[model samples]
Target: MFYLTSGVLFLLVALSAPAYAEQNLLEGGLLLTAAALSVMALALILTLRSLARRNAKLSRQKQSFQRLLAETPGIIAILDKNLLLINASSSLKSLVTEQDHSTLAIPVPLFADANGSIDLLPEIRQQLKQQGIWHGEVWLKNEHHCEAFKISVHNLSSHQGKTSTYILFGQNITKFRQLAAHQQQQQLRDDTTLLPNQLLFIEQVRQAIASCDEHYPSAALLILDFVVASQSEREVRLNEQQILDIATNLKLLVPETLLLARFQHNIFSILVPPHLCKQYNTIFLNQLAHKLIAGFNQVDSQGMRSPLRIYIGISISPNDGDNVDLLLNSALKAANRASEQSDSALCFADSANQQQAPDFLAMEAELYRSAAHGEFDLYFQPKFSISSNRIVGFEALLRWPSPKRGMLPPPTFMPLVEETGLIINLDRLVFRKACQQVSYWQQTGLMRGRLALNISIQHFTQRDFLRYLQDTLTEFELAASLFELELPESIFNHPTIWLRERLHSLERLGFKLILDNFGDGISSITQLRLFPLHGVKLAPALVKYIEQQEQQRNICATLIRLIGYMELDVTATNIETEMQAYLLHVMGCDCQQGHRFSRAVPAEDIGQLLLKENQLLNNQRQLAN
Candidate 1:
């Protein structure tokens, strides 16, 4: 308002002065001077107002910076060229002692050395001077504990382009470090027994082997196979308590200084150091094995005699093997040989026999390479309908033609495949091949029947199994009805609710489900009724002697009748002779698949077989007419 008034008055005086100039020159000059002074006064007022506004803006920016430093999550501090504390964030105050705060230097709590000396500060400063930045992890002393901080220090330059101050940034990494340590520990432990797992055990073995010298030239590896004696050769399932009890017993028998680990579900391993091996001889090992067997022979908590049998296999380093994998494998091979013996419960790896044993590692490597190169072939065995005397379908079997071995059957490689969890990949490969063959047959009109695929229980129960089936079918432009999934009878071992739902999902997708290898295991009629099965395939062993033995024949006939009464399509497998086929047909088994009809042939040979069958059918029709 004052500036406005002055400007108005100056303008009015200037206008009036021009008129008075002619009358009184002196009076007009004075008026002009007064107008000039008023103009200067207005300019000064405007400059002051502009300066005031700029000062207010700087004030607000300073307040905002102080607030940011106080509220920040991490530690932030500023130090002068002499390393005296110039400013610190609220977080930094928590780590600084009262006496240190009074000194105004870098806080002592930030140093992790024994005497609370800032030994790292000189190095940090040197790095900042050379590179303008330094970053590292440092341990900081908190109130009751030490915390890890990832610290970053930057050189702040002045207007003269010289380092004038330092800016320190710290992020607390205590929780992250703890979490990483926990995860590393978890990787070395077994989830069930809480013992060091295979990875850790292998590392320990490697270390022990490397530590061996002339004084202690050998280490001992013992593999204990805990087998439950039963009527059948099927795998024995032991509950968690039983497994723990077995582990506890082994621990008591063995010394605490030795390393023990669970190699597999029913297999445990012990590693004796080289010094111990030098102290104990073969006789000592034999006595220890006997002690383990005798200790487990006593009755159980239920007051019944324990059926657990212990087979301990011993392998010595520098004799059986010199490395971790070789030694472990030698022990495993010895354990397998011991399990086959009926009288003895222990076996030592003999160097002579070791030469004849198969190199499982080489076989495993070859199998993996073959699978990668698609060296596997599928052989289709035709399933004949006995009643109609026509081809109903074909069961697809996987065959590996190894370059070393002439032809390897499923039994030779499948156990290893399943053990290594490679069965999932093989199962997918088989499914795709079967779908492609079926699609080709449909396109050429060569044959018309469903193709049965034997799926492993692990692969069949996968969460993506149904989706994979749908995708493969869609890719081949084939219907699900053209495919049949032959699941093993062991699939019934899973929870009934989950198994039923999974089977029903497959059924809903239009694929037929057949229980494969029926009567191979101890499957009951009650378990059979719980599944949504379209058919059942008799295990070859169940009907192997049906032709000669009357008792076996009666049992086969009864099983066929019982299955027929259940309204299921029964297929008898491995029909090697005409008598077996005839017997099965007369016994109400309409479907038969075995060597008697046709051996498993390649996909290309299938077309010729179908053509021959068609020609035979045409000739029969003409004879009937």
Candidate 2:
């Protein structure tokens, strides 16, 4: 408009000057100059009006932009060329506690590396300058903790023309990050036990193996499983609840520092630290396996009190195999071998054993056939009473007479028996046969007093175990007071409420309970308080160690005194020397059993030995009188 007005004024002045040229040259010149001045004045007025309109429009746009910045959900900021904050939205300012925006010239430490370091600001600025834009996710350190944010920035020229500015926007992504972390956590844990699953366990073992050296020597892998042997290849396995119960009990036995994992339905794995492996030898692991079995035995399977049999396979790193899969395989193979043995219940992996893997299914078939025939025999180990100077009781031990393999010990086929559910039948047969022998002795006046019978946790925990025992005794008309049930120390590992109640019921029903191997595995005096135990059988290890080590002697002495205070009878087992016998007698042991008394013998041989012992006792009594 100013230019148009100026042009029109000049055009009119030029046309009038041509007309006035004839009147006077001087006057025309003055008129032309006045017209030029008027045109200049008009141009100035139009320029001022245009400037006012443009400034009003710019003010309205600034107000709208300010409102948008305030209402935005995320952080919005303007930073100068030096990465200094020129303007920031309220949302951006709310990140900090201070409300003073004046002191906020420099950018906050919101843009960060994955490790939450704010040292990447210079790199971010350089990138923005080179590429005109920068965008990505960054970690931000909040007042209390760190947060995640997706930041975006664009270079812009500032209105002042003094410096360049950056338009920055940041979106909070903390919840997303938390959700991702939770998903990762879920992937590494077991659903039932809430412990780490096999994947994590394998990873831990792999790391331990890789890092193993002279300074950080060895680690051990222990694989535990409950064998369910059947006549067929498809064995009868434990149900989900039974497996869960075993896992729960195992958790109680394992320490918190060690890693435990559920490998399969009835299998669990433990990662033993190098230090522990060095500290504890195979003996300690065998004891641990025994303790685990005892703890597992307390869980009732399908209304039965005895828990399923658990086999532990162990393989030390470097010694067995260095890698995860190889070590796991070796441990599994050793566990299979351990399943064939009854004592200790653990087998360490070795190259020789790995070469000869046994056929468990065939063994299971052989066991079933053996039980079907009357091929199983019972041997008696006499419990000699030091006070009475006679054989007061005998512990009934089972023996399998295999046509193809001669006499098989309990460890040879007992695990298979339990796995095949044949323990229920075999245990009943043993009890009935033992009671018959007792009744014969009482009728013939050959022997007297209680007969102690070893009961498998599997058979003992049966819902009908008590009924079966009562019926067997009644069938023979044997006095319940004359019968004693010897339970291994493993039974005390973790007795459930129901198991505790059943044990008390056994006492009420006239069955005497003897805690066998009292100091072995996880058994302690606490078990004595929890159950209705009439006697305790001191572990053979304690008696043997006492003879060799003074510390062991003191420990045994303290235990004997403790048991004496409880008023429970004590029997020391595995006494092979007169020195051991004399030491036990001085320690106040009521009875002793082992090679010194007699090795387990046939029922007929036991009867003759008892007769000889009774005659000897009578002569000693007469001499004393």
Candidate 3:
């Protein structure tokens, strides 16, 4: 450094002395070189400073990353091509067999065969061996631990000039399994009381299948359902949970061999072994169904009146699916189809391919269009007082002039519409048409009695069905009293606030409200305090089955005795034979409807009947006076 500085000073002195005694080019060149060297030295100093600052920044980043890796609690691991773990976080130590030096290896095997189908496991293992990367859930077994984890593995190139290695990140999700078992407990309701729940009796069903080690043993899944016609929010909330509970109780009674779960609000899924189904003895299945239906009548431990329903579907496996998800899905589809068809229950093995059952989308479409376009017509059968033979009222029974089919009765498709939410529109049309016909009858001086229309409570409870009724009544220019809205005993269900308000409003406007098919369903009469009803129509089932089913006849007798004290008028529908009419008259039934007097007739037939009756009554009165 001293020599360089001395050269610079000497050159400067020569240049100033005009070295060689002249202003020569050599002096000029020496001074120029000195000036250039000073600028180059300054540039070199700045470059070195920049490099040092960059190195310091990089070192800090490396330290920060190292600290993060050491502090993270989740399972962070690296494995070789063989899937043998090389590195993992300390928290994952318990997941592995501890080594002498003490480190962790998060094993992957606890998630194996979780859904009972793992054909992909072996294939994944082979790919991971070859590629050094894989991602999925796997079951890992240790002496004391078994758990599930979501894992992701990556084949990473080595930074330290070594062979590439695998890095994995996993976090045990044991809680997830527990939650899965519990989620549906809240989603679905019991069929009877409609409680929130489903603990699919898996162990019982699995054991049953195992017990039948010899025969054509297989498990079947059943789904059951119920549809309420009320659309009031108050009714829905009150019923939703109890409905789930009812479904739960229903699932419980289908035999230990059947794993029953409340899969939907109105549906129950039952898993049963094929051979355990009693060797084609359908009566056994029907017995089981009856038992479930009966069980729904029990007052829950909470003493909440559980007015529940039971609809079931069964799907047997190997026949349905080899895996749980598929089997469960198939069973659900079959159950849905059964509800649509109003079948006692359905089997997944025999249902339509599109569903676990043929959703009969065709039937549903046909019914929907027919109902929506008012292709279906109503026929009013006179509901007359037996004692006075007075034409007090008429029950408007819906009749579908199906495009491809003849007149379809209520049992044929009312259920489908109710389940599909199409009944709301259908009911509206029925109301308007019935009212229009009644008005026409009045104009002909043939109609002096009120018209009764059945209201699907589900329409009032689950959907925004109020508009339809309000609009139809306005369009027909019919007084509320001119029409009597009929409903099931279920309408008296708990939490009747909204239902009461709507019914009372309509009642005050002069329309009468009636309960049809009242015997047995909707056990709670408390809702009646809120309902402004004019009468109850004994369900046709009660009357039609009376002679055939002793139990049904007795129930009808009891209802006839009790309902009157409540001051509600009674109408007997489906009084087929003269004998049935005598029984109804003996029971003091006020009015009757059935083939005994006349079948449901069109507007023209009713008009003529009403006109003739009026003329006859006038003549009788004149003669008596």
Indicate which candidate wins on TM-score: 2
Error of 3 at 119 (Å): 47
Worst 10 residues of 3 by lDDT: 229-238
lDDT of 2 by residue, 1-625 (tens): 4544555666566666776563565555566667777887888999999999999989989887787778887878888787777777776676643574633686657646556545667788778767777888877665654667898988775433334877889888889899997787789887777778888888999988887777557888889978554445345778777777778887889877778898877789998877666532443454455567677666454676553567888888787888888889999998888877763266779654333224444566678887888679998888888767778788888999887788978877775575557888898889988888888888887665688888888877788998998888888997788888988775654456876888888888898898888776677787787778899888877998777899999999999999999989898988899899989899899788889879999987866797787788789889999
Q: Write the per-residue lDDT of candidate 1 for residues 455-568, one digit (tens) a residue.
A: 998898889999999999999888899888888987877898998999899999999888888887868667777788988889898789998899988988888888888888
lDDT of each: 0.79, 0.77, 0.64
Residue 539, candidate 1: alpha-carbon lDDT:
87
TM-score of each: 0.48, 0.53, 0.46
Candidate 1: regions farther than 4 A off: 1-358, 618-625
- Candidate 3 per-residue lDDT over residues 1-625, each given as its tens digit: 4445665666667667754654565565566667677767887899999989998989989676555546776677666554556665555555665552233343334346545344444665566556655677765556677667777777676443244467778767777877985565544544354333354344445555555543555555556666542434122323566554554555466566555554444554565665665433232444454556566545778986544334555555656765666666766676666656642444444544325133344567788777656697778788777777668778788888877767789876665566567887776777778878877867766766788888777665645556566667688776677778777666666466766787777677777777766755654455444567777777776787676777876878887877777887888887789888888888778688777777788876876776777797899899999
TM-score of 2: 0.53
* Over 4 Å off, model 3: 1-359, 462-464, 524-530, 545-558, 611-625
- lDDT measured at residue 431 in model 2 versus the true structure, 0 to 100: 90
